[model samples]
Target: MEFSSSLTLLNSKTPFLLEKRILLLEAILEHGSISKAAKAVPMSYKSAWDAINSINNLCDNTVVLRETGGIGGGGASITEYGKNLIQSYTILQKEHTKFLEKLTTLTDFNSGNLKSLQRFTMQISARNQILAKIEAINIDKVNANIVLKTKSNQRLVSSISKNSIENLVLEKNKEVLAIFKSNNVMISTNNVKGFSARNKIKGLINKLTFSEVSCEVNILINDTDVITSVITTEAAKELELKIGQEVYAIIKSSDIMIGN
Candidate 1:
């Protein structure tokens, strides 16, 4: 059987490798210099340098080093740490292949359903995703109230229709993730009062990025978790938002999506 899948070595928040970068690293080891390695991997010298810089930034230790003025001037080689990472990735690749082989041997495997599932498994365009667990779910005749406790112990409230409660099988103590677009989150520098939105998470402004019309504001909660909101550029300037300023992320419960 022939199938294709990708293996990624990720740090807690960032990807550690793409296969091409790993191939370039492997070429560095075999060819003994960045210039030669670039030619071996058929990559431009500038692209190879950029990959090296990215690799160094991702790791705690310097993974690749440039040597100079020792009979041979200015060449590059992988560090011991980098070599270890390569070996680890090679082992992971073999394990991935074996796992795929085992899957093909299963008798009741449904490829059609798996393919359909893969479509939804793709990364959504939403900018904010918060991992949470259901603390409580309140139900009335028409509406359902859902309470979510995030990993950082921050609380969020969501309201959905009774039909959604039944269809999604809402329950207490269930692990789920909340997804919402940046524009769905409203930002306020002052205390929000008499608002229709159910979720109001207070956080410190970590960063603010501007576009032509809008700006993306990143807020850090409890020094751990982060949520982002998109607000108009004019609003941002009016609020006089700066790094470390306190702000609130307001989200309507109906706007939040619950993913199992």
Candidate 2:
């Protein structure tokens, strides 16, 4: 048997996902039944169904054919769409394995090198990464204040250490990514008095998703940029957030982050 490795499809700029779904589809094609496919992959039937549903949502065209009651009873079949996806995945897997083989052959390969490469390719937990241009900067002995402008004319300020300023070569007009955790954003329908946060970006509520413990809200600013926020569901109800309601997304300069 030949050596093999695995890979998933994703990139830093346009994050996309596909892997087990491809495998499930391939198994369905071989077995001609969803249950059989699930068994082949050692996954629960519910999980298989969920994966199939997710794949269906991602495609405009149906990738699988299901029959409720036919001459031979209900069964599943891989459609042309699914076959094409399987073919593409098979090709990518082969190339990805070959890349891993080559990496193994490198003389200086070590655990640290592998870890560094993994971090380089892995996506961070931060959901929002807005491209902004540095408009101004203020420096003190320890910390630096960075003012950034988005394409829609909205401005944000981020505070970082003086060392970060010199390390990233940050200056006026230099393009940088302003990243902040979704949980760090505070939502308010009305401005509170004597707030300390430096940035209060006003935008319309575009979407709101609430779960038991947390609520995820998307605010549309400058008509194009969407700022995401995750807060306690209790807080969301207190604010009485609704779509089209204008709200302010408050962030501290220290909570904002910078990336090249």
Task: Give all candidates' CA lDDT scores.
Answer: 0.84, 0.83
Q: What is the C-alpha lDDT profile of model 1 across 130-244, one tens digit per residue? A: 7788999988889887899998788888777888877887788876678789899998887789998888889999999998999889999998889988899999999999999
Models 1 onward score TM values of: 0.53, 0.54
Shift of residue 179 alpha carbon in model 2, Å: 0.5
Clash pairs (backbone) in predicted model 1: none
Candidate 2 global TM-score? 0.54
Q: Which ten residues in a row have the lowest lDDT in candidate 1?
A: 107-116
lDDT tens digits, residue span 1-260, model 2: 23355566765653244677777888889988888888888688779778877777777788888765543334689889878878888888888888777766763543344444544664789987777889999998889999999876899999999999989999999877799999999988878679999999999999999999999999999798999999999999988899999999999999999987
